[model samples]
Target: MKGIRAKLSTLLLTLLLLVPTMANAHTVSTTGPSPDLRSALGRLLGEHAILAVVAMQKGIDGAPDFRKAANALNQNTDDLTVAIASVYGKDGAAAFKTIWSSHIGYFVDYVKATAAKDEAGTKKAIADLEAYRMEQAKFFADANPYFDESIIASELKHHIDHLLSAFNNYANKNYTAAYKDAQTAYTHMFATGDALAAGIAKQFPSQYSDASSTNPASDLRSALEQKLGEHALLAVFAMQKGIDGKADFADIAASLNRNTDDITAAVASMYGKEAGEAFKTIWSSHIGYFVDYVKAMAAKDEAAAAKAVHQLEQYRMEQAKFFAGAIPSLSEQTLAEGLKMHIGHLLDAFNAYVAKDYAKAYADVRTAYSHMFPTGAALAAGIAAQFPEQFHTANTSSVPSVQKVWFQVKSNLLTIDGSKTTMDTMPFVNQGTTYIPLRYLAEGIGAKVVWDASDDSVWIIAGENKAEFWLGADFMEMNGQRIEIGDPIIMKDNRTQVPVRFIAALFGWDVRYNTTDWSITLTKAMAMEASSNHH
Candidate 1:
C-alpha cells in the first residue's frame, strides 16, 4: 500500500510540475515564444511523436506489443484532451478527441492494410487519413480564430505527409529512410505544439503568460529538462537501434553522443570547466554501462548483465556524491535515492523493450523522462542558491490544481474521484450488465491481475482479497465462495472483459449506471463513505 501510494504521489507530482501556472493579464509581455506554454505543449507533442513511432513500428512487425503501443497512444490522447479542456473547456476537448482519434484509427487501418499486402486497402486508408487531416485542421481553426484555416490545413497536410512517409518507408524495409522520416516527424510535432500553444496563449492572455519575462528561472529549468530528458530518450533509441544492427545505428548513436555533449556544455556554463569535464565523464560512463547491459542481454549472458547492473549501482553512488559535493543543499542520501529511481526506470524501460513489452516500455520511458526534470530542478535550485546574484528573482509560480474527470464513449464526459482517463476498449452493455476490460478496471482500482494461461484463469489480487475466474465461466471464486454472474468471462479484441457491476460488487465498490449519459461510475465504498462524511 505504501509503495502504491508512493508511486501515485510521484505520478501526481510529475504531472503538477508539467502544468504551467496561470498568469495575470497585467504581466509584462514578450514578443517571442512563451516558455510556459511551450513546455506544456512540448511534453505532450513530443510524447505523441514517440508513441506514434513505436505504434507504427510494432504494428508493421505484427508484434504483441502493438496493443500496448496503441493503449499508450490512447492515454496520450487523453492527456491532450485534458490539456485542450483546460483552455477551451470539456466540449472543445471532446470535439478535438473525435477528430484526433479518427486519424489514429486511420493509421491503424493503414498498418493493417500494409500487413495484409492489400494495396487498395492501403490507398483507402491513406485517403481516409487525408480527409481526417482536413477535419482536424478545420476543428482547430474553428476553435481558435487566431489561426487561419488555410495555413493550419497546409501545416496539417505536411504533418500527415511526414508520418505517412515514415510508415511507407518502414513497410518497404527502407530502414535508413524510415528512421530519418521518423526523426523528422518527431521533431515536427514540437513545432506543432509550440505554434498551437502560442495561439492559445495569445487568445487567452489572462490565463497564459510567457515564462521568460516573469520567471526566467522556471524557463531555464524547463529548457534544461527538455535537453536532459531528450538525452535519455535518444540514448535509449540509439541502444535499440544498435541492438537491431539497423543501418542508421551510427547516425542515431552519434545523435545521442551529441546530446551528451550538449548536456555537458550546459553544465559547464553553470558550473566550472573542470566540473563540467568531470560531470561529462561520469554521465557518459553510465551510458556505457547501459550499452554493456544491452550487449549482455543480446548475448543471453546473465552473469554479464548482473555485472553491468552492479557497475551501474556504483555509478549511481559516484554520481550522487558528485552532486552532493557540488551542491550543499542536496543531501547525498536524497540524491542517491533519486538516482536509484532514475537508474531503475531506465533499466526497466530497456528490459521491457528487449522483452517486447511495449506498453511497459513506453510507460517507463515516460516515467524516466519525467524523473529528469526534478533532477534538473534540484541542480538548478542549488546553483541559484549558491549564486544568488545571478538569479535574483524568486520563482513565484504555483502548481496548478487539477480536477479529475470521467469519460464516456461518444457521449457526455464524466469523472471518477476527480480524475479522467480513456480506454481503447469502451465499456458496453451485454444483456442487462455492463462489461469493461478486466485488467484496466482492476489496475485502475489498484489491483493486480495474474493470468494462468494453462487453465485460462485470471487471479485478481486486490489488497487482502482474491478473486478467481476462468474464461467462459459463469462462476467466480471470491475469497473461497463461488458466485454466479449473468455474463461469463469473455475476450474481445485481445482484452479480457468481465461484468462491471459484478466485479465492482465483489471489490466492495458502489456502481452507478448513468442511463442518460451512457456511462458507468465505480466508487470504492471507503471513498464513498469519506465523500459523504465530508459533505
Candidate 2:
C-alpha cells in the first residue's frame, strides 16, 4: 500500500515540476500592449495571483525545485516593472521592481516557516504579505501620479484576500475550500488584467489606443475559442469518471488553458463574431449529443446511436450556412480550414471518451480548448472593420479571468478530524433516504449499466441476467439488490453523487463522504488484499 502511494506521489511530483519548465523558467509573461500602464499593472497583479497558486502547490508537494518557483515570482516582479515603466517610465519601473522582488523573498520565507510549523514565522510572513499589498499599491499610484492609490488598494484587497484563503486551505488540507477560493482568485485576476489593460490604453494612448474590449480582436475566431474552454472542462470530468479509458484529466486541463488561448483567438478573428456564435451553438450542441451518444452506445442501442450521428451531420450543414453568411471577405476555402480544426477538436474529445482512453481524450480536449488567444490584434481586427477609429483607436484587449472557482469535482462535507478538512481530492455528496435505482444497486453485484439519453432509461447486465435503473416515479424491478436506506445518490453538477457506501459495497470496499460536514473516508479493497498478501 505504501509503495503504491509512493509511486503515485513521485509521479505527481514529476508532473508538477514539468509545468514550470514549460512555463518559460518561472518568468512573468508580459506581452501585448506594453505601452499601456494600467493594462501592464493588471497583468502583473494577475501573474502574482497565479504565482501564489504555484507557490502553494510547490509547498504542499514539498518540491526541491526552487529555481522554478523563484522564476515564477521573478516573472511576476518583471510584470510589475512593466506596469511601473509604462506609468512612471524607466525610473519608476526600476524602483518598483526592487520592492516587488522583496515580497517574493518574503514569500519564500513564509513557505519555509510553514514547513517548519513556526507560529511566529507564520505571523511574520503574513505581515510581510500585508505590507507588500499596501506599499505596492501606493507605489503604483505614485508611479502613475494621476490614478488614485486608495482605489487600487481597495480593488486589489479582495483579490489578495482570496489568494491568501486558497493558500491557507491548501496548508490545512482543505483542498475543497482551497479550490473554491482558487476560482475567485483566478477569475478576479482577469478583471484586474482588463482594468490594467484599460488603464494602459487610457494612460499611454499613443502606443495602445487601438485596443478593443467589446469585440474579440478578430471575427474568425470567437466560437471556436468558447467551445475549446467548454471542451477543457468536459474532458477533465469525463476522464475522472472513468468514462474515458485513460489517465487523470486535471493536469491536461491546466496545460490546455496555458497553451492555446492565443491560437483560438487568432482563428476566430479570421471568421468574425456572428459567425463565431453560429459555430459555437452548433459545436456545443454536438458535445451534448456526444454525451447522449455515449449513453446510447453503452446500452447497445444501435438505432438511438445512429440517430445521434444523423443529427450531428445535419448540425454541420446548418453551421456551414451561418459561417457562409457572416464572412464577407473569406470564401468557403478559408472557412473550410477553420471548420476542420473545430471538427477535429470535437472528434478528438468524443472519440477518446468512446474508447475510454481518457488521457488521450484530455490531451485532445486541452489542445482544442486552450487554443484561443484573446489578444489586441484579434480584437482590433474585428473592431477595425466595424467601428473603425472609435474602437480601433482604443486598446482594450482585456481578457479578464473567470471568477467563481467552486468545486466541479471532489468536494467534501467534513474531515476525519471533524473539521472542514478539505473539499478536494474527490467529489462527494450528502447522504439521503431515497429509493435506489436497480441498476445502481446492481453495479455492486458485478454489473455495468448504461443510461439512455433520449428516453432516460438505464440498461443493465450482469452475466446474462438483465435489469434497469429507474428514478423518480418509476416502478421497481424484482431482480436487482436493494440499496440501503439513508444513502441515496444525490445529483449535483450533472454527475450523480452516490453515497460512498454504495460504491464501496458494489466495488468491495468501504467509503464515506460527509457533505454536511465536508469529510471523506475510503478503505480500498486492495488494502485488505495487501494485508493478506503481507501476512
Candidate 3:
C-alpha cells in the first residue's frame, strides 16, 4: 500500500507540475459569431472570480501562496484582456485592461487595510471601489448598447461585496460564511460572462454570423462548464478545510453535495432519471474517496490512503463508463483518461498543500479549474448531437411523448403509448397485489430499471425520482428515505416481479384496475411533453 500510494502520488505530481502554463487557455473560436466565444468568456470571467477570492483569502492570512495566487489572478486578467482584444481590438482591450486592473488594486487596498486593522483605510478603499464601479460600468455601457450603466454598476457592486465579505469573514475566522461568500462570488461571474457575451454578440451579429449566445446548445455548454469547474474548485477548498481541521469543513462538504445535486439534475433533464441516479452515486463516491484520502493523510495511515486511491482508480473507470453510455460520442477509454487527469489534479493539489508547497497547490487549483471547460464543450456537443430537436434553434419538430401504458394480469402482452409488445413474464396476482415484471413495467412507463449484479438489487428511475430495492427485500429506499413494502419482490418465471400499484405510485403514474378483466393501466405525462409544454 505504501508503494502504491507513493507511485500514484508521484505520477500526479509529475503530470500536473510539468504541464506548461498558457496565458489564454480557453476554447478559442476564430470563426465569426460562434457560441464558443460565450463559453470562452464565461471560463475566463469565472476563473477570474475564483482566483480573486482565493488570492484575497491568501492575502489576508499572509499565506506563502499569496504571491502565486495574485500572479495567477493577474494572468487570468491578461487572458480576459486578450479575449476582449479579439472582439473589440487592441485599443478597446487597453481601455478594458485599465478599468479592470484598477478595480483589482482597490480590492488589494481593502485587503491590506483589513490586515492592518485600519478601519479608515478600509473605508477609503471601499470608496475607491465605489468609484471604480461607475468607471467600469461606463466602459461596458459605452462599448455595447445592451449594457445599462446602472445595472452593470449594481452587478459589479455585488461582485465586490461578495469578495470583500468573503475576505472579511475569513480575516475574522468566520470560515463558513467566508467560503459561502467565496462560492457566490465565483458563481456571480458566470452571469456576468453571459451578459457580456450576449451583448457583444448582439453588438456584432455579423462577426458571430447570426449565432445566438444564449442558444440552447450554448446555454448547455455554459451550464456544464460552471458546474464542473465549480466542482473542481469547491473540492480543492473542501480538502483544504479538512486538512486544516477547520470548523467549516462540514459547510464545504454540504456545498459539494449541493453541487452534486445540481449536476445530477442537469443529467436527469437531458438523459433520464436512471442516468442521473447512477451519476450521483458515482460522482459522490469520488468525493468520499477524496475525503478518505484526506483523513488517512491526517492519521498518517498510508494503507488507508492507498486504499482510497484504489477506490478512486475504480471510480475513474466507472465514471467513464457512465459517460460513455450516456454520450455515445464519448468513448470509455478517452473519458477514463480525462477523469484520471481530474483525479490527479485534486490528489496532486492536496499532496502539495500537505507538503507546504502552497504555490504549486494553488497552481494546480487553477489548472484543475481550467481543465473543465473543454470537458463541458465535449459533453454539450455530444448531447446536442444525440438530441437534435432539443437543440434546434427553430422549433419545427417534436418527439412523440410516451403517455400511457397498459398491462393485463396473467397476460404477456403489454401496450405502451399505443404500441404493443410482449413481456417475457406476464403480470400475476399474488394474494391481493398484482405483480408485474419490474423491468417491463418500468420501461413501459418511460422509466428505467437498472440491475446491480453485485448487490442483487434493482433501481427504478422515473423523471427526477429514483428508488432502489434488493431482490426479495420487503423495503425500498428513495432519495435516502426507506419505505416499507408489505410485498417483497420475487422471481416469477425467472423474472423479477414487483407490486404494480406501489411502483406506479412511486413514479407519480395514475393506476387503474378494471375489475371485469383485471387489466392494469398506468398513465403519466412524460418528461418530453412536459418540457415542450413548459418551453
Candidate 4:
C-alpha cells in the first residue's frame, strides 16, 4: 500500500508540473451583446471553482471557519442545481446534485484518509473518485451526444487528478506545489464549464435563444450583467468572510471592489465619463454601507447596524433616482422597488450568514445574483430604446415560433428550428454555390421530404407547394411547372444535396449567406415581419 501510494503521488505530482495550462480566457465586450447562457454559466461555474478550493483548503486545515467554507460550497451547489433546472428541469437538477455532491464527498474522504496516514483508506477513496469520474462523464455524455463520452471522461480524470494532487501536496507540506496545483485546478474548471455550457446551449438552442446578447451591439448589456451579478456574489462572500474573520476576507473584499471597477468602466463606455464616475460613487457608497453593517454586526452594535441599514435604504432610493434620471423610460418607482429588493436580499444574506443560517444566506445570494440580470436587461432595453440606431441591428425579434438554423462549414452539426440536428452529409461550398442535404433542409423548413428510389427523385411538400427534382437533374418540377435551376441536384455521401437558394426561393423564405462566418440563415417570410419590427 505504501509503495502504491508513493507511486500514485509521484505520478500526480509529475502530471501536475507537466500539464499544460488551459487558456479559459474570454473577453467581455462593453460594446457588444453575448448570450445570456454563457454569462450565467460562466458565473456559476467560476464561483464553483473558487468555492471548491476554499472549502477543501479550510477542511484540510481543520479550521474552525470550515463551516463557512462548507456553507459557501453548498450555496454554489444550489446555484448550479438551479441553473441545471432552468434547462433540464427539476428532476434533472436533483440527479445532477447527487452525482456532483458524491465527488465532493470523495474528496473529503481522501482528506480524512491522508490525515490518518491510512494508505489503504486513501487508495479506496481514490478508487471511489475514479468511479465518480466515469459516472459524471456518462451523465453529461448521455445528456448530449455532442459531449463525447471519451472526451468527458478524460477531462473528468484531469479534474480529479488535479484536486487530488493539490490536496496531497498540501498534506505533505509542499505549500508552493499545493498552491500551484490549486490554481491550475481552479482554472481548469472554467474550461470544463465552458464545454458543458456550450453542449447544453447547442442541445437546446430554444432555451438559449438570446444568443445575440454577446454580439458587439449588446456588449454593454452583457458586460454589465456579468459585472453586476459577480459583484453581488462576491460581496456576499466577502461579507461572510469578514463576519467570520476568515483569513481570505481581505482578498475577497478586494475582488468585490475590482468588480465595481469593471461595472463602472462598462457604464462609462455607454453613458460617458462623468456619468460613470457618478455611478461609481453611488455604487461604492452602497458597498461601504454593507461593510459598515458587517463591522457593526461583528461588534454586536445593534444601534450602529440599524443606522447602517437606514443608510442603505436611503442609498437605494438615490440609486433608483439616478437610474431613472439617466433613462427616461425607466420609472423611478419601479427602479426603487427593484433596488429595495436588491438591498433586502443582500441584507438578508448578511444577516443570515451572521446568524449561522447558512442555507438561507446562500439562498439569498442566489436571489441577489439572479436579480441583477433583469436589472441589466431593463437598463439595456432603455438605452436601446433611447438610441435605436446603435442597437437596432443587434436586437433580435422576440418571435416565439420562429426557428433559427446555424450552419457551420465542414461540420455535420446544425441547429435546426432551435434544436441540434446531425446530418449524414455536411453542408459544403462547391465553387460559389453552397449545397445542403435535401432531406435535412426540407425537414428543417417544416416541409415533408420524400424520396422515390424508383425514379431517383425527391419530393418536397409544404402546404400547397410541391417541388420535385431528380438526381443529376438541372431542372426541378415545381407545382407541375418546370423551372431551370442552373445547379444540378447531386449526391454527396449517399444523401441528395440541393442548392439552398433554389429551395429557399421555391418556399418564399429568405436566405442569407454570411461568407465571413460561413453561415446560412433561413427565416420564413412570415417571421420577417416580426424581425423587421424588432429593428
Candidate 5:
C-alpha cells in the first residue's frame, strides 16, 4: 500500500504531491494536529522527485551520507514511479518520468549550492529549478493550466519562492521559517501538479489523456480508489477539509465510516448481488486481519503477531484467487502488480511503525486501507452483473470501499485477544478423544491443512474464510463444516498428524502442497499471498 500510495502520488501534479501522504490538514495556528507546509513538502519530497534529485547531488557533493541518502530517496522514487506506470500506462509515465527526472537533477544542484554556501550555485540551482518550473508549467499549460498561464505562473512563482526560502532557512538553522516555507512550497507544488494533470487531461486530446484515471471500470482505477477510501482516512481528511460537513451531503469520499461501500456496490452494479456480497465477505476478512496486526503491534505479543501474519497470508492467497477466478481481465502477473501496491503500502506503514515515525506510519496505513475502495467497488460492480438484487441494496453511491475496509480492519485489529489461526492440514477433531483427518472441514473453510510429523498438524489457512475445531475420528465441526474423520492422524518426521487428501483438495486449489517435495505450490491465486506485511 505504501508502494501504491507513492505511485498514486505521482498521478496528480499538485495538491497531494506537495503535502504529507494523508496526514490531516494542520496549520501553525495550532487549532488541532496539523503539519506546517514545509514539513509536508519534505514528506512529499522524501517520496517524490525533489528529494531524489537533491540527495544525489548532495551525495555527489560529499555530504556524509550522500550516497546512502540518495539510495533512500531514489528507492522511494523508484517505487513511486513503478506504481504510477502501473496505472497511468508505462508509456505515459515514461513521458512523465523523463520530465520528472530532469527536475530532480535540477534540485540536486540547488542542494549542492546550499551545502557549499556558494551564492552563485544557490542562484544557479534556483534558476535551473525555476526553468524546470517553466518547462513543466508549459507542459501542463499545453494541457490545461487551470487559469491563464500568466496568472497561474505568478502563483507558481510565489510558491516556488517560498520553497526556496524554506530550503535556505533549513540550511541556515532557521527552523521556524524553514517549516513555514516548507509548507508554502510543497502546497504550491501540489497546486501546480493538480493543475498540470487536470489541464493535461482536459486540454490535450491527442496526448496526456485521463483514460485510466480515477474512474471506476479498469483494474488500475479500481485499485487506486481502494487506497483512497480507507478507514477514517477520506472521512477524516474530508472532515478536516469540511467536505463531509457540506449541506445536502451528496458525496463523502474522505471521512470515517460515513458509509464506504463502493467496491461492493461497483461489483454489484456491474455483476449482481450475490457476487458483490461474496466480494464484500472476502474483502472484509482481510480488513479484520490487518486490524489484528495493529493489535499485536500495540500489545507486543509475539504469539499474536505470528497468528496475525498467518491469517493475513491466508487472506492474501484467497483474495488472489478471488481476483483470478472472478476477474476476466486479470492475469496472475496483473494481480501481483495490483496486490504489490497494497503490500508495499502495508510494508511501508509497518516500517514506519517500527521506526517510530507515527505520522508516516499512519499516513501509509491510511493509503493502504483507503486505496482498496476502487477495486472493491469494481468487484462489486462485476458481481452486480451476476446478482442484481443484492447489488441494488449495496449500490455504487455510498461510504466508499476503502472506508469500509478501514472500518473492518480497525475493528478486528483493535479487538484481537489471543485467537490462534492454525496452518495445519490435518486438523484434530476431538471426537470421543480420537482425532481424524478433517479435509472436508479445512477445505470447507478454504484452509489447506497439512500434517507435519510426530503428532503436530499444520493447516495452511488460505483466503479470508476462517474456522476452528478439534478434528476427531467420528465427527468434526468448525465454521459450518461437518465431517467424519475416516483416516487416523499419522505422524510424519517431526511435526505430527498428516492429512494428505483433505488439505490438498481444499486449499491446494489455491496453494498446492507437495508432500513428496515438502513444498507448497502457489497457483496464480495462491502466489498472491506472498506479501511482506508490517510485523
Candidate 6:
C-alpha cells in the first residue's frame, strides 16, 4: 500500500503541478481515534476492492465459492451505505446505494461480457461504467462542499480503470499482472476512503469535534495500519491458494512479495536503506516459514511442521529485537507477544481451512486482518515519537508573522527571520541569474523537499504548490506548465542549486535584490498576497 501511495503521489505531483492552490485543500487523515471514520471507510472500501477482485475471478472460473464471494462484496457495499447514512440521513443513503450498486452491476456485466467473448457487450459495459463515474462523482460533490465534481469524477475513473485492468488481465490469464493490478486496486481505496472521511469531518466539525484529518501523525498511522491489514489478508489468501494447489497460487505469492516490498520501503524511509534491507530479511523469512509449514502439512510431515513452527518462533524474536533496537518506545517483549498472536492467527486460520472448517477459517481471517490496525498504530506512534520533526504538520492557516530569508552571493551566510545561520554551500550568480541552495531555501520557508533517486528529480512542496525539476533539465514544471530557466540546474558542493527567482515565484516569496549589499531578500507574508496575485 505504501508503494502504491508513492506511485500515486508521483502521479499526483505531476497533475498537481498545474493547480497549486487546490492540491492541499483536503488532506486525508489515516491514524488515531479522531479519524475513526477515515479508518472505517478505508477498511470497508479496501475490503470491497479485494472482494470484488475475488468475486470476478471466481465467477470467471465457475468456482463453487463465487456466490459467497459476491455476497461478501455486497455486504461491504451495504456497510459503506450505512456509513454514508450516518452523515447524510436515510434519503442520501438510498441515493448513494443506488448509484454505488449500479457501478457494481456494471463491473459484473463487464466480467460476464468478457467471459462470454461478447465484445459489443463488453464495450457497452465500459461505456455504462464511464457514465456511472459522473453520477457517483455528482452524488459526492452535492453532498460535500469540499469535493469538486470534476475531481471526484477523475478519482472515480481511476478506481474503475484499476478494477477493469485487474479483471481484464484475469480473463486473459495474465495471472501475474492480474494479481498485481488487483492489489493496487485494493490499496487505492484507502485513499478514497480517507478523502471522503476528511471531507465529512470538515463539513460537520461539531460532530467530529476539533480533530483535524490532515495531521501528519494521523496520516502516518493510517497508512501503516492500512498496509499492515492488507498484508494480513493477503497472507491468508496466499496460504489458502497454496494449500489447495490453485493455479493462481504463484500469482498470489507474487502479490504478497509486492506488499512486502512496500512495507520494507516504508521502513527504509524511516530508518534508512540499510535498516530497510535488514527488516526485509527478517520479514521475508517469516513468509518463507509460513510456506514451509503449508508444504509440510500437505505432505503430512509432522517433523517438518514442528521445525517450521520453531523457525517462526525464532523469527518473532529477531523481528521484535530489530524493532526494539530502533524504536525506543517499543519493547522486544511486547512486540514478540504481539507477533505471537499474529503467527497464531495465520496458523489457526490455515489449520481450520485444512480441516474443512470454512466458516472458522474465514472468521479467523477477519480477526487476523483487524489485528493489524492496532499494530500499525503502535508502530506509527513509535515512529512519530522517534522523528517528530518529520511528522510535524504544516499549518498554513496560522502564519502569524512574515518569514524573511536573506542570502548573500558567494557567501555561505544565510539569515531567516532575524536569525543567522551558515549553509554548507553559498549562493552564486551565473550570467546575472542568482542560484540558491535548493534544500536550505525551500526548508527555510516551511516547504517540503524530496529527492527522488529513481529519476534524479527534485520535488518541492509548499502549502498546496508543487514544482518538479530534474538534475540536468533547464526547465521547471509548475502547475502543469513548464517554465524555461535559461540554464540547467547545477550541483555545488554536493548541493542542488536552482534559480532562486523561480522558487520565489512558485511559492509566492517576495524577492528583492540589493545592488550594494550583493544580497537577495525573500519574504513570504501571512496573507500570501503576492503568491495569490502571481497565480
TM per candidate comes to 0.60, 0.42, 0.66, 0.55, 0.32, 0.69
lDDT of 5 by residue, 1-535 (tens): 1111111222111111111111221111101111112122222332342333234433434644355445555555565456446435677556656665666666677777677778898788778777766665554344332323333444445555655665566566554544434333433443333333333333433443323121112222322233333332332222221311333122322112213254454444334568668877876676556556655666678898788777766666676777777666455555556665665577566656455564575466446644555344444344334333322222221111110000011011210112223333333323212122334333332345554444233443333222223422322222223222223444322323433223221211122222233233222221222322200
By TM-score, is 5 or 6 better?
6
Estimate, for each residue in 1-535, the C-alpha lDDT of model 6 and write its tens digit: 1212121122223222211222233433345445677778878888888878878887888766566567667877898899889899999999999999998889888888888999999999999999999999999978986554654675587678779889889888898978867776776677677667766876787887646553555666767787788888889888988888888899889878878887787777566678989999999999999999999999999999999999999999999999999899998999999999999999998998788776677667767877888798788778767765444434233212335677799899988777777899999976545788888765654567889889888888755556778887766664333444534698778888987644543333345556566777665422222221111
lDDT digits (tens) for residues 218-324 of candidate 2: 21122222323334443334433234322323333343332233223322433444544555566556555555666666677989778877776666566555545
Question: What is the alpha-carbon lDDT for the whole of candidate 1?
Answer: 0.64
**Candidate 4 C-alpha lDDT tens digits along 375-475:** 87677667657655443433221212334556766779878667888988898867445788878755654567788999999887644445678999866
Predictions in order: lDDT: 0.64, 0.44, 0.72, 0.65, 0.40, 0.73
lDDT (Cα) of model 3: 0.72
Candidate 5's C-alpha runs over 4 A off are 1-147, 150-195, 201-260, 331-341, 344-348, 355-535
Model 6 stretches with alpha carbons more than 4 Å out: 1-34, 209-211, 392-535
Runs with alpha carbons beyond 4 Å of true place in candidate 1: 1-37, 115-122, 169-177, 209-219, 237-251, 269-276, 321-333, 353-358, 377-535
Per-residue accuracy of model 3 over 230-304 as CA lDDT, tens digit each? 899889978987988876789778878877887786676556668779899999999999999999999999999
> Candidate 6 overall Cα lDDT vs. reference?
0.73
Candidate 1, residue 432: lDDT: 42
What's the number of clashes in each of the models? 6, 70, 2, 11, 97, 6
Error of 1 at 184 (Å): 3.4
Q: What's the C-alpha lDDT at position 351 in model 4? A: 89
Q: Which numbered prediction scores highest in TM-score against the true structure?
A: 6
Candidate 4 ranges beyond 4 A from true positions: 1-47, 50-54, 57-98, 110-131, 149-201, 204-222, 384-387, 394-535
